[model samples]
Structure formats: structure tokens, C-alpha cells
Target: MNFAIRALRKNEQRVAVLFIMTIYPNKVSASTSPFAFIKDYSGIPREQEILFSTHTVFRVGKIKPTFNYNRLCEVHLTLTDDNDPQLAALTHRMRQELCGSTGWHRLGHLMLKVGEYNQAEELYNELLKKASTDSEKAHIYHQLGCVKDEEGEYKDAALFYEKSLEISRKTLPEDDPSLAAIYTNIGGVYHNVGDYSKALEFYEKARQIKEKALTPNDPSCATSYNNIGSAYYHMLEYIKAVEFYENALEIEEKTLPQNHPLLATSYCNMGSVYKDMGDYLKALEFYEKALKISEKALPPNHPDLATFYGNMGQVYHNISDYPKALEFFKKAHQIKEKALSSNHPSWAAFYNNIGSVYEDMGHYPEALKFYEKALETSEKSLPSNHPELANSYGNIDLATSYGNIGLVYNSMGDYSKALEFYEKGLEITKQASPPNYRGLAASYGNIGLLYRHIGDYSKALEFYDKALKIKEKDLPLDDSDLATSYKDIGSVYHDMGDYIAALEALQNAFQIQQQTLDENDFALSPTYCCFGKIYRGLKDYSRALHYFEKCYTIVQQVLSEKDPALAIIYNNIGDIYRLMGDYETALSFHQKALNIQENVECNPLDCATTYTSYGETYREMKDYSTALIYLQKGLHIREKKLPKHHPDLAVIYHNLAKLYLATQQYNIAMENIQQAMDIAQEKLPLNHQHLLDYRETFEKI
Candidate 1:
């Protein structure tokens, strides 16, 4: 410890830390001496030194600052012998994965495994120059292709893979297992470029070859199944994706060691599929299993471990556990920063996820900052023509980044800026080769949402229909994405004063949800909420309450009690009670809503809804003074958050007009009613229910 501290004191450039390592070696292992004490041969005989073997593995333990010095730390390490189960299993799997005919080949494979892509490429290229056989040249080409693939040069990867395939075909049998590996590589290149159909073709070819050439439970076959599953996942064919993923998992569980890293990949793949299916609990189960195995089989800062963390974060994000989600996201980012380059395409995903959590929390400026960081990272790391940035989810292309920014702008009430970014994203999606239908659908849906927010019901319907048409043509009938399209169209129709059309579209969405999701799935909550709103518009109080309660039940099952989304449901239920003339019950629910909305970070407009609901209930009970206070509070938030002519603003105006008229303040009521009339005349359809209500209130005044 004194020797290490003395050495650190000689560096004058900056503060340098000294790591005093305490190694606990396993003396019971007789196979090898992992360390040797060499005091006799030391130049400084008084300072005894111990030398450890090059390949000795250590499990890191406690690391803490010591000796009251901020820079100095004590690190505890346990040296692993051959008897260590985790080390033994990881070594065994790694040897199998990196199997090669020569030490040089194994060295090249190791370089690739440790993410030394440039070194691996140079080694393979030099080896290619000296290759004596066609098989040797083919293997070297395939390795080079892997290097390019890891470096995000997909076109070069495809070329190298094709070269290897061409040579292998001429030299080897048609059913060679080696050829299947090449085919899978080619499929991966296609997958990275967002051409799922082409990727599927190559993946299927690899699967067929593997099945014919290998045993029924061969681990190689599992790789093919996983590749096929990933393609289906990208294509939005969740059923097929699950089937293939389970097939891969079955083979892996049967053949691979429990703690093998490949098993972690299978588990993560299954988790991703479940997460997208809206089965968050199941997703977390699989992600935990994957994380446990990865912790045992890989280094602490391995990129694969980061992927597991990212998967766990995604599940928490879907369930609206923002703090837990952010915690997991930052953990993943810490690992990624250690394992990957700063501008690596993978960084975009971490940035995007954290941005999404902020967006949902209604922190638009913070969300936009992270979204722009994602865009910058993506542009720096990915090719111009690359459809998706290709993260753990294999989603979030450059187009998605633009759309994310647009969404934040839309939430911030900068509609023109939102539309500009949305249009840019749409154009990029349109230009994607082989036509990324799924991405196109999402872009169209975003634009549609922007239009709906601006009260352009006809324009919203146009874009939503375009999105729905593409989904219908490309996605399975029971796909959750298809259900989302139905929900969007339904919401627009509900806004356009077409109750029958709204009910029909919502029913279509519900049917799809029933086919694909559990009854209590969080995805079904929004559909139920939409159904409740439509019934409320029709004055069917009982049916409206029934749907609202169903929605609330699902939300309670999925989200935390204090989640901002829960506050919205509370406000909805309160308004339903008020409509049914149960003022006390309505006030109780409104209080519950305010308890959450006032304390949490959420859209000011959502908080305004609760205030307005309280005002309506109080006015009905003839509490005019309290009603005015709540109405003014709601009016202030709406005016600040929404555009001057927004239809939602008109609703608040009409509510205030009713409260003022009930108190016989005719002049003040007339002013509020005229403001509502002006907004409705400019923004809403003449026959819209809100406009009709405004007219009725005008007559009363």
C-alpha cells in the first residue's frame, strides 16, 4: 500500500488514485498456481511482491475510498479457480463460441468479441492475403463482414457476406452449416436496413438449411429461429415472432448451460416481444432471467448487460413507473458509456427512452433536449439510408427521432414547429427502400394526432385513414398497431360529431384488443376510456360509467396509484358522476384527482380538466362562490396551456358561462358565452356537441 501511494505522488499532472487490490485466491484448486510470491527475485527485497497469472479471473467486490483520501480507494477481488461455476460455464461457452482451427483465428474472434472492430478487420484482411484455401478465404471474408456489421457499415457488411457466400457455394456442399451462418449474417444486414421482408427471406433460408444439416436440438438451429423471430418482430407479426422466439428458447434451454450468455440473448428476445405485446409483467420476468444469466456470464460493463438493463427500463416505462424507469435507464447508460463509443448508434436509444419518459411527464423542454441529442447521435453513427437506428428493440429510426421532437413541440402548443418536424419524418419514411410500411404508418399517425389536436377533424381523419390503410395492408389483423390505428380514427370521429362512426371505429379497436390482449391489459384501458367518452357524448350515463370504471380498473392494475395517468382517469370518473347528478360522489372523485394532479408533474391541461369538473359539480349544488373560484382556476390554466381558439378552451368558457348564469350574473355570463361562441365558430364544426351546448347556454343567458 505504501509503495502504490508513493508511486501515485510522483504524478504532478492531475489527481491520481491508488487502487490497493486485495485478492483472495482459492488454495484448494490443485490444477494450477494462479499467483506466485517472488520476494527472492525482487529488486527491492524488503518490499515483497506477488505476481498473478495472465489468465487468472477475479470477481470484484467492495470498492471504497480509504485513508480519508478522496482519490485513494480499496478494491477487494476474489480470484476464481477452475471450480468457480460461473467462470467455468462462461469459459466453456466462450471457447465453443470462438472455436477456430488456429490460434490466430481464435485471436481474431476474441478481438471481435471484445469490440475491437478495427483490429479484427485488420487481422482478417492480413490473413486473407495469406489464405491458401478457398475455405480459409471464405472464413476470413465472413469475419471481415462481422467487423463491418459491428461498425455500422451495413453496405460493406452485405458485400463482404455475399463474397463469402459466393466462394463457399463453389467450394462446399449446398447444405453446409457454414453457409447457414453466412445466410444469417446477410439476413442481419437486411434487418439492420429495415427491410424485414428481405431479412425474413434470408432467415428462412438459414433456418431450412440448419434444420436439414443439424440435429433437432442443435444450438445452431436456435440461432436461426432467433433470427427469424427478430424479423417477424420487426414486421409487427407478434404471433409469429413469439412462436419463433419460443422455439429458440426451447432449444437453448434444452442444450445450453443455464448461465450461458446465449441463453440470455434468447431470454431478452422473448422479453422484448412480451413488452411490445403489452404484457409488462411477463416482459419483466423474462428480462430478469436474462439479467441474472448475463451478470454471471459477462463482464460488468459488457454491452449485452446494458441491453438487459435497457429491456428492464422499457418495461417499467410502459407501466408508467417513471422513477424506476429512469433509474434503470441511467444504469443502462452508465454501462453503455463504459462499453461503447460516445457517438455509437446505441446511444440514441438511451437518449430516446429517457426523452420519452420526460415527454410523458410533461417536461417538454427536457424531453426536447434529450430527443435532439438522440438525433445528433443517430446522425453521427448511422448511414443516411439506414431506416432504423437498430437498437435493442430494433426500432427508433432517424424518422422516429424527428417525430419524437415533433411530439414534444405538439405538447408544448407549438403546432407549426411540430408539423414541420412531422412532415420531415414523413418524407424520410416515404423514401425508405422496400417501403418501411410500419414506420410510414407511425409517421402518418403522428401527423394525424397533430391535426386532431389543432381541431382539424377532416385533416386528422385523412392522415389516420392513410395510416390505417397501410397497417391493414402490411400488419396482421390482430396486431396491436392495427388496434392503435382504429383508436386514433375513433377519437377523430368522436371529435367530428359522428357518434355512430365513433362507436363503430372504437368497436373495431376493442375487437382487435380482445383477440390479442388480456382483458386487464393496459392497452385496453385507452379503448375503454374512448368508449366511455363516446357514451358520455350520447348522454348514456350508465353505460359511460361502466366503461369508465373498466378503464380505471385496468389502469389501477398496471400503474402506480400516484401516476399522472391515474389522475386523468379520476377526473373522467368524477365528470361522469357529476353528469349523473351525484354531486357529493363527484366532488369526492374530483378531490382524489386534485390530490394527484396538483402534486405530480403532468400537462397543465389535464389538471385543468379536474378543476373544471369540480366547478361543474359545485355549481350544480348551488355553491356559486366556490364554483367561481374553481372555474377561474380552470380557466387560467386552459388559457395558458392551450391556443386561444382551441376547442378545449371553448369547453372551459361554456362551463364558466353556465356557472355565471346560474348565479344570475347575466352580463358576465354573456361575455363568457360569446368567447365560447367565437372559438366554436372558428375551430369546431357547427353541429359539434360542444357548439350545440354553447348555443343552449346562450339561449339560457
Candidate 2:
């Protein structure tokens, strides 16, 4: 064991996995030799080696880091014989499911089941040459299709499925159950390429044939129902998705054992829909149920078990429970690390999820590191044009990896860098066959946000409108994503100072949230913040404070004390107090905001907000010298992070002008007011409130 460990440790950069098997020969018949001692025949006698049969089965046991190494682990395995009921039952069931005519065919099917796609494809191609009948050829072609589909070669998968279907149709009826399986697989190929409507058409065809030919509660029918539900889920029809998922779950519950992996999968499907619908508690409940069954039915490091953990992590992440989300994500990552190759596509998603948590925590550098890792892994595992890179399922697409990096850059106020990545993602999404509309929408939304930040309101609206139109056509009216689109549009309107339009859009967003999400859900935080900003813009001080406080309360409940969002909320609340002429209270809140902004790894722009707020409060209190200091600090950050003509820069310039005027510095006041006027004229609408205010300040100077 020591020699093995040392030999593997020679590669310092690569992780090493060591499996130690414990076998009891007495558990099996004396004549059935599954493994043999080969130490005596070895040239190096000091190194003991045992050769195991190809079909040897083992029950995985405890796994832990070895030798205090982060990347090395020891996995314990106990050899299982025919006497092990679970192993025997699983083997029998798999053989039944494969249902091949020969041992070689069965082996090929099993290889596909275990994700040995290349081996399965090679085996099936070889078998095809020797096939004696149409039935045999059809089976080989179908198996090849499955292998190609798993490899993300959707065009090949489709062609193979078509070949199999053409052969099978000559002898099989249109409603034949065997034909349903081929139709379902064809639907899967369409689904992989983001053609959900086409996928649904085939899924419904499979369901219809199953309903007519199979027993009502048959597991095969449940599989069809699950596929239909997944299509609806991707189409953002949550109610229809839930209905089909429940139908599948009900059948599975009645037909399968409590710990069956299929039952677990049904629960996971339900959980995912609820998670997307913003029902976090219900999502968590279903996810935990899936986890319970998966733990009992699967090996400790099974990839399916990891999926359950990742689902729970996503629920926690959506609710802003960062630590719990991190814990679950890390658990999933560990399992994948131990079970899969380093370049496996699943690792890209794991890295992306972990990076998202860090990003939300304002750890920009850490977030960028993980996002880049995800991008690198995706590039290594897939072809550049592989549609699976944008799948939005377990796989990570190249576009998604780029978009994630863009999000971190956006948060750090690197707008040009953010735009570069976002455009790259958009270009990829645009190039996808069948035009992956969902990926396109996400890319559009990201670019819209970037344009909004850089003071290009018209461009922001253009991209945002494109995204909204897609959502309006593709998603249910009350889908959370649709609400996000509305909220984003409302925010842009607020920035443009179109108070009535902003209110209308925000009301639409809030109504959808009220219908789909809990009142205190963190998903509502941004809507509340937008409402507060609109109220403040309208000079409704009391209402603005009320809305800001409401946002603050939910954010406090969801995020950590030092969260970047919390600092932003604090700054907003302080600005509300300043508007209400509560100088002392405003300063106190600004102090709190500054404390967090100064200590954490947050964007410099967020720190600038607190500084500007403090400067405004100090100026109102007639402390001109101190106001100048704070305003200069804010100005320095804004100049570094924002575009010269950004609306936010204009606001800060106006504040500096006010401070200089209060101090009777006429020349400096004129210079500052002129700068503010120039930015406002360039970035804002002619009739915008900021532009009007800048005009008045210019007159005074």
C-alpha cells in the first residue's frame, strides 16, 4: 500500500485515487475464483499484485483524504459475490433491461449504460457488420445512436436513430412499444439541440404509444411521462411540468420499491421544477426525499447521488444560504472528483456552481478563478461547437462558462471585459442549430445589464427588449425568469427617470413574484430595491424609506452580514434617511455600509456609493471640509471604474459641485457643475430629472 501510494504521488499536480479491496473467498463457492494471487509470478516480488476477473463486483465503502493530501483519497471496496442479494438483483435487472441476444451484445449494452461511449460505439459497429437480420441491425443501430447521443454528436445520433427507426418500421406497427423507445431517443436528440417544441412532439408520440400498449402503471410509461415533464420544464411551463412529474412519481411509488433510483429521479425532477418556480421550501423538501432514496440505493460516490446533492445546493444558493450551498456543492464536487475523470463535462458545472457562491459573497478574484477553471474544463472535454456546452442541464456549455466569467467581471466594474465575454457567449448561442432561444435570452440579458451600467440606455433597452420578447413567447407568464426580465426593464426605466413607466414595469414584476414566490424570498430583494429607487426618484421620502427598509429586512435574513448586497442596501437606506433630513441617522447607516465595504472583497463602486452618501450628509450638516474629503474619495473610485459619461458619474459630479458651492468656492463649483452638465447631457434624456437638476446647478454656478 505504501509503495503504491508513493508511486502515485510522483505526479505532484495530478490527483491520485487509490482503491483498497477487501475480499472474502468463503462468501463464494470454492470453484468460483473471482480473483487470483499473482505475487509469486511477478518479477518484483516486493510488490504484491492481485489480478481480478473482468466481472468482479464490489460494494464501495468509506472514502477519505489520504496522507493529509487535498487531492488524494483512499476508497475502500468490499468484493461482493452471488450471495449478495443487492448485487445479484441489480445484475439481473440490468441484463433484463439490456435484453441482448448474445453475451457480446449484452456487454456492449452494459458498456453504454456505464458511460463507456467509445467502447460501446466500437462494439456496436463491429456487431452491426455481422448482424444476420433486420432486428439485429436495428438493435445495433439503436445502440450506436445512444452512444453518439451520450458523446454530444447529435447529428450522428439523429441519423443513427433514423436508420434504426426505418428498419424497425417495416416490421413493427406505428404504435409498437419498441418503436416508442426509438421515437423517445429521437426526441432526446432534438432536446439536446434546444428544439424543445420538436422534442415535445416526439415525447408525446412516445407517451401515446406507451399509453395504448403498456400497462397504465408500467415503469416504461413512467419513463415516457418523465421525458414529457422534462420537455415542459425546459419550456418553462411549470404547472404542466409538475403535473407530468407527479404522474410519473405516482406510478413509480406504486410500482417500484421505496429506495429505487428511478423513484429518486422522479423526486429530483419535481424538485428542479419547484426550485425554478421560486418555491424554495417545496424544492428542498423534494430534494431531501430524493437524497434519502439515492443514499440507500446508490454507492456512496455514485454520480446520481452527487446530482441530488447538487440539486439541494442549487436550492440553497437561490435562497442566498451561501454557507449551506457551499457545503452541499463541495460534497457534490468531491463525489465527482472521485468518480469521474478530471476533464469530464460535469466538473465544469460543479466549478461554475462553486464559483457562483463565491461571486455572491463578493469574492471576485475567487469567483473568477473558478469560472476560468470551468471554462478550461469545458474546452478540454468538448468540441468548440458542441451544443451540450449550452445545454443548461448537468453539462456546462462554452457559452455558459464565458457568461459566468462575464458576471464576475460585471460585478467588479470591468465593463469592457464583461462586454467582451458576454458577446462571445451571445455569438455562440446565436450559432446553435435550432437557435437555442433560452441560451440566447440569457446572453441577451447579460449584455443588457452591461449596457445599462455603461450609460447606454437605448442599447440596454434594445437587448433587454429582445430578451423579454423571447421570455414572453417561450416562458409561462408567471415564470421567475419572466419576472426577472420585467424587473431589469423597470430598473433601466428608473435609471432613465421615467418614473411612471418604471412603476408600471415594476408592478408587473411584483405581481408575478407575489403569484410565484414567497413574500420574503430573496428573489424579491431586487424588486424591492427597484421600488425604493423609484420612490426616491419621485421624492416620496416616506415611501422610499419604507421600501428600502423592506428590502433591507429580506436581505438581512438571506445574506451574511458582510455581503456586498447588504452594503448596497445599507447605502440605499442611508440615502433615504439623508433625503428625509435625518442627518445623524443617515451618517450612522452610511458608517455601517462603509464598515462592510472597507473590510470585504467587494466592488470599489459599492464603496463609492457609501462615500458619496456620507459626503452628501456631511454637506447638508454644513461640514464642507469633511464633505470634500468624502466626495473626492467617491469621485476617485467612480473615475476609475465607470465610463466618463456614465449617469452615476454625473451624480457624483453634481454632489461635488454642491459641496464646492456650499464652501463659497465659485470657480471650482463652476468647473464641477459644467462637468456634471456635460455627462448628464451625453447620457440622459433631455427631459430626465438628472439633466434638469444639472441645468439648475449650472445656473447657480
Candidate 3:
């Protein structure tokens, strides 16, 4: 290395000889041996990559690329002109002079902020290794824990935080604010693991320590309140959570500026509580206010903005405004897509949200497409057992595909197949998720519906009870989800010849739905239909007619007169009139149902049932010839259009046998009777009334 004189003029000896100092990118001064690793690297690209052991200046472009942790220190700080001893002295003197506590802290903070985490960790490691006091060591450990938390190593974090606390306890006073800081950090780890009780214990510990150390007006006191509120909210204690949240807001509002970020967070938390309580309008108001503030203060693509958009989408979805929901979901999705990397879980999460909106809008094709994309993205980003990976699979199962290709086979009337996917979804939901999970309850309700359709009342009841048990304690008892469980169980009881049980179940369901849902809510129609069918089973024709008429009117009001549900409700009304022996009114109502089914798109099986009812009415009038023709027509359709062993088809087989027997066609009666008996015996229990009726008729044959 070249030496520089203090005052050189044309190579004359005008100054005393001096030792020239040099420094490597490793930050090693000439005073220390260069072998020691004074420089560390984060192993990230686009930074100093260490090379040659000497203090040699090299061109920025002429460097060996960094591999692993060895040489990253030189990549970011390429040496430029090591020939000038004074210039070299600037580097060496900086390293030697900046070696105290302030220098260490500043370097550590700078490295962490600039994303040189490995270098920061190395600095912190050195600080801890050379710490001279318990307080210094505790500070180093606490800072290390913050980095570990950021890296998602919660076990390591807990250890560091605990160590920090232990040392602080031995050295610092019991009421020190440092103790509060450690407690807060430990609580964060517990919260991530879903251990809300442990989280709350630590948060309260922190709060107590903070209260002892500082006045009530301290900003840290507000942080404690906010964190406690979050823990309570996770525990589903919304009232207590709201109280704490409001307390936090009060102090923050009193002290912090109106435009501060903490005020936005407080508004969002209050909005979340209102959303959970099903007060969508109120939730929307608060969420919008938070959105306005965040939009003004945060970057457009910030994660907080994405959260605001997603939460707004939820409010719109709750209000049945699918188009508005789609718009907000898209806004969240675009931000997440750009802000997050292609393989990040956040991108996949927003993909799932947008797909769900497609599902709600009856766009099954688009739903399946996006769900597959989400599943693919999630698999690439997360581990195999990630909860969101299962959700992508579940969404595809519910969104129908080409013909019988989609997740749900509802359009194909394959309720049993749909139940299969529902069971799979439930298993994944429970295994990967927490108790009282809404998705699991939704699957249970779905399986219950399949059992009900197959006339298996016992199995149906078991599943419905399972769903309701999960829902009742978690959601409001009057929530739409619980109301569905009540309605399904009531329908099962009505089908099982338990009218009193059906009435009790259906009435409770109707009351809850009426209380919680909009007056024109579509959920009301099913409850009304269940009530009507229960009355009809009890043979209270007048009450049945009243309930059925109410159902029809409401269905038309909500879904329009030409809707398929309206046609189906009309058929139910016709059945009650037929049972009442009001032939003229029964015929009129049946004709209206047939007209709707024939002219408008309706379920083929339901249309066939209308023919079966017409045949039964003709037989009761003793018009044997017309009854035989109509019964044969119903039987033909049921056999061709329905599953081989369908319960509804069995009903048609029984009616056909009865019509033939009345016409004195004994051989034809025997053939149809055997068909009915085989189907009923295979599909239903011996104690079932359908089987009982068919068995007596077969004995006569």
C-alpha cells in the first residue's frame, strides 16, 4: 500500500513519517488481524460480496458473486482507490472509532432497517457475546427476539423473550417498562398459536407492569388495551372486547393526533365487532370511515388497504349485493396480487375470495376456474397441510363443472355424491382449523340435506344435530345458519310422521329467521314450506293451506312468480286441497302447478310428482281408466328420469300398482307391486309407512 506524507511537495520530505491505515469491507481496521470476520452478510442478493483478504480497492464490477454467508460484505461497498492512505484511513478510522455502544446500536438498527438481517443478527450476536452487564445482555436478547419473531420462529422467539425477562427480573425493578415490553412480545407469540388464554395472561401481565411504571396517559397503556381487546375478540367475548377497544380509542383520541394511524386501527376493530354481531349497515359505516382515513395516509397497495377492501366486501356480501362485493374483492385482489409475490399465500388467499364471489353469483364455470388457480397457487406457496390449500379444494367441489364434472352435483340430483365432498371438506376443516369453524358446520348441514332427501330421517337428524351444535354456541342463535339447521331437522321430523316435533322445530326456526333476516329474505320461504308440510302431515288442511299460501306468496315476492320454488309451493298447496276432498280447488291448484312446470324451466322430478298427484285424485274420484293412464305416465317418467332406487320413484311405483289393482288388472298390479316392494325394501326400513303400505298390497297379489 502507498503511504501519503502530511505535507508533500514534489516528492520532498516535508512531513514526519506516519503509519498508513487501511480497512477491508469487513470493517476490520489495520489495528486488528484481517483473519477475524469483522464483516457479516445477510446472504441476500444485490449487496457487498467479500473477496481478497487484503485491503485492496477493486472496480465495482470486478467482484466474485456471494454464495451463502461468506462474502456478501464486499458486494455492497466496493473499495475505490486504496492508493490514497488518507482515503483508506477514512475507512479504518471509522471502523475503530465507531466501536462503542452507540456505534453498535446504530449499525445494528441500520442493517435491520435496510434488510441486511444476517448482518444485523451478527452485530446483535457480537453485542450479546461482549455485553458487560445484565441490562445490556437483556436488551440484546430482547432485540434478538424481535428479529426471530419476524422470521416466524416462534419457539426461538419465546426462548429469547423469556431469557430477556429473566435477566431483567434479576437486575431491573419489578415495575420496569422493559418487563412490559417482554410480556407484550411473549403474548404476540401465543396469539399467533391460537392460545388465546395464554395470550391474555401475558397481555394482562404486561398491562399491570405498564400501569405500575407509567401514568394512565402513557401511549403504551393504550397499546395494552388494544392488544387485550384483540385477545378477547378472538375468544368470542365481543362485549368485553368492545369495552377494551373503546377504552383504547378514548386514550388514543385524547393524546394522539386525529390523523394518526392508531385511530384508523381502532375504527377498524370496532367495525369488526359490529360485523360479527350481524349489524352489516353499522359495520359498513365504520369500515368506510376507516377506509377513507387509510386511503389518505397509506400507500394504495399497502396490505392495510387490501384488508379494508376485503372487509368492505364482507359488508356488501352480507347485504346480498354480490356485484358490489365482487368489485371490492377485485380491488383487494389486484393490490394483493401486485404487492405480494406470485407464490405468496396472501395472493392465493385473495384468489379464493374472488372465486367465492363467483360461486355466489351462480357463475360456476368462472368459480371453478379461479378456484383451481387458487389451489395451484396455494400448493406452490404453502406446505401440503396448510388450511387454505384445503379451502381451494373445497370450493371446487361446490362449484359445478361441465355436466357432472363440478364440485357439487346438485343440478344432476346426485345429493349423495355432493354429501361425499361435503364430508371430505368437513374432515379437512376440522383437522386443519379450529373448533366452531363455520366451514365445518356448513358441510354438516349439507350432508344432513342429502340424508333428508333419501328419506333417512335417523341419519338426517344425527347430522343436523351435529351442525346445529357447532353453530348455536358460536353464532347468534337467530343467525341464518342456525335457522337452516332448525328448518332441516323440522322437515326430517315431518317426513318421519312426527308432526308435533316438526311443529316445535319449525316454529323456532321461523321465529329466529324472522327476527334476524330481512322481511323479504329468501330464507323465509323454506321455513314457510316446512311449516306447511308439517301441517299437511298432521291433516290440518286449513292450516296447511294457509301456510302453503304464505310460502307461495313470499317465494313469488322474493324470487318472482315464474321461479321454480313458486311452482313447487303450488304443488304442496294442491296436495292439501286434494286431501281435504276439495276436488275442484285441488284440480285448479294442480293445473296452475302443471302450467308453471310445463311452460317454465322446473325440476323434471317435481313435474312428474304433479302427474302422480293428479292420478291419485282421479282414483279417489273412482275414474279408474283416467287414473290408470295418468299413473302409467307418472311411472314412466320417474323410471326414466330418476335414479334407479330413488325414494320419489318408489312412490310412483306404489301408485301405479294401486291404479292397476283398482282396474282389476291383477297381473299388471302384481308386476308394479313387486317393483315398488323391491325398491322400498332396499332403500327404507321395514317399519317405514311406505314399506308397510306396499307389503299389505303385495300379500293380496
Best by TM-score: 1
Candidate 3 weakest ten by summed lDDT: 397-406
The TM-score ranking, best first, is: 1, 2, 3
lDDT tens per residue, model 3, 1-701: 02232234334634333222344554544564433432465364454434455754433333233343221222333444435454454345335423236778768865543335567778899888888988888888987887666544566778899999999999877778879989998998777555667789999999999888888987679889989998998776777889999999898778665555566788888888877755666688889888987775555666667888998987776555667788998898777765545654445456666666665554656765776676566456435444431333333322211211223344345666656556655665566433425666766776777776656668889989998898887776656667778888887876666778889988888787677566545446667778788877777889888878876765564354554556677778878888999877777877788887787645566777888888888888888788777777777877765567767777777887887787788998899888888877776756666788899888876
Clashes of each: 0, 1, 12
Tens-place lDDT per residue, model 1, 352-373, is 8999999988889999999999
Best model number under lDDT: 1
Candidate 1 residue spans exceeding 4 A from truth: 12-27, 30-32, 62-74, 381-396
lDDT score for candidate 2 against the true structure: 0.84
Ranking by lDDT: 1, 2, 3
List per-candidate RMSD values in Å: 2.9, 5.5, 16.3
Which one wins by lDDT: 2 or 3?
2
**Model 2: per-residue lDDT, tens digit, 1-701?**
56556766787776677898887867766767788889999887776878888987777788888866667789999988757766565556555677689999989987776556678888988999999999999988998998878765676788899999999999998998889989999999877665778899999999999999989999899999899999989878888999999999989888776667788899999999988877677888999999998886676767777889999999888876777898998898888877667876667778888899889877889999999999898777655564452344323277898999999998788988998999888887777655667788999999999899988898999999999999888777777888888888988998899998999999998998898678887678888889999999999989988888998988787567877678888899999999989999999899999998898767687798899999999999999889989999999998987777888988988998888887889898889889889888888899999899888888887
Measured with C-alpha atoms, the lDDT of residue 196 in candidate 2 is: 77
> Which 10 consecutive residues of model 2 have the lowest summed lDDT?
387-396
What is the lDDT for 168 in model 1? 95
